[model samples]
Target: MILVIDALNKHRFGGILDEMYKLRARVFRDRMGWDVMVRNGREIDLFDQLDPAYIVALDGSYNVVGCNRMLQTTGPHMLSDVFQDILCGEPPLRSATVWENTRFCIDSERLKRPGADRTVSYAACELMAGIAEYAFNSGISDVISVVDPAMDRILKRCDNAPYGYIGKTVQMGKTKALAALSDITEERIARIRAFAGITGEIFLEDDVVADALAESTPVTMPVALRDYCDAQIAGACTDSEREAALALQRELAGMYRSQPSCDA
Candidate 1:
């Protein structure tokens, strides 16, 4: 499932964005050997301070399997500021209709396991489709990105090729980088959906689905804990004693709820 997480609605996701940062740390630092800042196993940078929107891809269990960030071009973005060297003296493109895409990555190790197909990782393609849909709906027409050669090729293969390029392809970290432009159109979205075998909307639509799922799903708490709580409530002599037992049960349930949905 795809989630559009931003500063305003981030509180609803419960550390999902932190999981995305951990994924970025593994992909950019361990896998790609990028010079990035990773504190407590999470990768974060100045661009994140700009309050960019994140496209987070989660598995059936809500594990963060893929992710990307979108920032408007009128402000400081990766391509315009951090990757200014790629522009090679040319000024970065800034327009209201255009946005910047960065940190596009998928958890290939997780995808290679049982439920996912390695050759055509649907999570990656799903992210692309999510970007197209979210951008078009948000009034964004195009996006600028500093993509590596491998990602550029993947974009082409997925029928979401960059419409144009700007500046020289310079070496950035362990990979060569070049600025790319991708137009958000219906045909492009349709092509991506076809390639990824997506039949319906991939978006999970904020906390509505999450809240509904929680409400419908049956909770199977440990019988021992349930019995203890029941016995305590039953033996209580005063109303305050009964309230205390109930509060304890609720507190324990809340502890479980606050735990990470799945490890990154």
Candidate 2:
């Protein structure tokens, strides 16, 4: 199950740090060619230490497969410090209760199988839902995300979209789109939590155990179906292989499209 721990540096970091570093290097340095600070086969950065980030997905072997980062607007953040040049003015999340979303990466290489797919999606939903619950309990009402149109769709699918615009997007590397809370709902949160089969006193709105999964941590998929994902990741197997991957990706993309939003 996806665990959402605060100040996770003290604990969860130990379990997924290495895997996260490797995944970052592969995607940022090797694949995407984004300049990164690497030392001794590890990607090190100032943001890692300062940001109150969340690492979301893990495999059965406890390897990290997908993750995202967030920072409060208090200190030097995306608005005043980093991407200011690309921003039109003050960051939308600057004046209110909001968490700045950044560097959301999915280790597609690791997430090639069915197990990986379910785990990644589940983790994302849980993390977003958990954040919403935390915000509600803490008396904070806004969860801000700076993303592109593509990512905005993804967040909406998982149920985190902006209520209004705080700042407009100019140009930040790519066209950046920002979304705020108000879009988070109790019903959507319950649906996502139920799907993930998370059981705990999460300080959330009430819901009940409905099935065998009431008290258990849910796995994204049955073990048997992962073989198909594994085969696809290993490379195209036949005429259908490529078609299958494309179709699956489109399906996943559609999930994001379901909840559309304007700029944050």
Instruction: Note each model's CA RMSD in angstroms.
Output: 10.7, 16.1
- State each model's CA lDDT, in order: 0.80, 0.52
Residue 100 of model 1 has an lDDT of: 94
C-alpha-based local distance difference test score of model 2:
0.52
Q: Note the residue pairs that clash in candidate 1.
A: none
Model 1 lDDT tens row, 1-264: 789987666544434665788899999999998878886677878787677889988877677899999999999898877888888898989999999998999998888888664333678899999999999999999988778999999999998999999888988788888889989899999999998788887898765644543454355235456446645543444446646866886776676666665563
Per-residue alpha-carbon lDDT of model 2 for 40-104, expressed as tens digits? Answer: 45554566557365535554444566656666766656555655644466443464565666666
TM-score of each: 0.79, 0.58
Candidate No. with top TM-score: 1
The local lDDT score (0 to 100) that residue 103 gets in candidate 2 is: 60
Tell me the deviation in Å of residue 151 in model 1: 0.5
Q: Give the count of colliding residue pairs in each prediction.
A: 0, 5
Off by over 4 Å in 1: 116-120, 212-264
Q: Which stretches of candidate 2 lie over 4 Å from their true place?
A: 5-12, 28-43, 51-53, 114-120, 137-139, 174-188, 191-264
* TM-score, model 1 to reference: 0.79
Best by lDDT: 1
